[model samples]
Target: MTYFVYILETMNNKTLKYNLLVKQFKNNIYTYSLYMLRNRMDADDATQEVLIRIWNNIDKFNYSAAKSYIMRITHNLCIDFLRKRNLLINRELEITEDIEESFGDESTESNPYLVMQMKIATQKIKEAIEKLPENLKSVFVLYEMQGMKYIEISKALEIPINNVKVNLFRARKKLQEELKIYESE
Candidate 1:
């Protein structure tokens, strides 16, 4: 009776901890999915699939490495979703911009001109990101948009840190070129 009670308590504790972990990263995972998949419905589906996999693999998980593991799973699933479609022609870009997330000097404010300009710029940026190659886009989204560190991205994407840096650099350069017309006078 005592042994069974201890086992039950341990199992409860593990489940509680896993639930907390899931809660902690849920938004990040969903946001990543949204950016990668570029559609709200697909992002929601991908997030659900990723979380289910996380729960199923919880027993084999180590807490410290859980984040990278989860992200890796997410990246793989997103790529798989893309591959199964056979081409990007079937993928639709979600036009709603999350411009409220300030990227350094860019501001989402109440001024009409500023707001209009920001919207235009945001649209251009979104187009630029969408046009990027998969390798560059994933690196850019993870490191720049998702706020993952280079090392974290490297681990999640299974690429070298230098490769992450190079890809990010290229992604930014391409965006600059693509959106050059939107630059302020």
Candidate 2:
């Protein structure tokens, strides 16, 4: 009963509905800001800004297009923040192939070596990801971590889909190179 009313309020743009909308989008807003800023304080600030904008503009929201609308807002805000910092933000990202290969369902109980190897590989991959250039890192996080399609990413970044593909390819190449060095060491 309460849940249904909340939804109605949200749809009808009541004061209660506005709060409900904020509750629903809060996690996504925080996560998006965190990914863009890579700092908790800045992410917090971004989240507040997004919430304020959403609250003030709730009347403009169309239920059918709400998801895409929110994402566009987040994407634009991130780009604006980056621009203000004079950063050449890239949206490409690479994941370590070796980590992907090792991700099969192997039981640690059956083979201790497999468990240890998985742990080490996971840590190494994380380290490698952190070391990647910002462009590759962003692309990797957006595609792999956030599970956004290349087309969606292209729209968000205002880049061509082909550029998204190329950036992903280059990011993968960088990851492969880093993995090779790790293996050789």
Candidate 3:
């Protein structure tokens, strides 16, 4: 019947959209989760959950605002994961395990001394970021690392745009102070 054919076509279209959405945002979700949860396994679980939620609510969300919507889901899920594990406070991230992945591929330089220096600098920066307060860390990671805009972060974290700007500023200041201290040592 015509109705049956129409239903099948709609389902196919939805499936195609969902696939494209996943392809676009999966890395972002996983990266956010990795920073928030600070564990590979937990990040993986959170990414999977976010993807599942996106699929389930595919028809309900506006694709125009899809990035914020998807990131909000990811942020919430990461918070829940942290709370469930009682890591909301006194959280310590193992920076060594995925440091290369978190930052990027290892330097391809031929100079061993330069590569070593780069790795040390990267590790120090990562440690400083890990030491930031949760509020600042969230803002810093979302803006600097995830390439999210102020408005996008505000919507995703359910904070005002001004708050996003303030938090990002504070995060940067704190990171600078931390790096300064490291340099002195």
Residue-wise lDDT of candidate 3 within 1-185, one digit each (tens)? 35433443356487887887888899999988887887778999999999999989987866666778889999999889988998777666675767566434445535657767777888898888877887898889989998989998999999999999999999999999999999999
In candidate 2, what are the lDDT values of residues 99-139, reduced to their tens digit?
45555456534686877677687867765665566566666
Taking all chains together, each candidate's TM-score versus the true structure is 0.77, 0.59, 0.84
Candidate 1 lDDT, tens digit per residue, 3-115?
A: 43344345746677667767878987887777777777778999999989988887777566566788899999988877775645536577454554443244433666777
Weakest lDDT window of 10 consecutive positions for candidate 1: 100-109
Candidate 3 least-lDDT 10 residues: 1-10
Candidate 2 is scored at a TM of: 0.59
Worst 10 residues of 2 by lDDT: 90-99
Off by over 4 Å in 3: 1-12, 100-109
Q: What residue runs in model 1 are displaced by over 4 Å at the alpha carbon?
A: 1-12, 97-109, 181-185
Ranked by TM-score, the better of candidates 1 and 2 is 1
Rate residue 149 of model 2 by lDDT. Answer: 80
Error of 1 at 137 (Å): 0.9
Q: Scored by Cα lDDT, where does model 2 land?
A: 0.67
Candidates by TM-score, descending order: 3, 1, 2
Give the winner by lDDT. 3
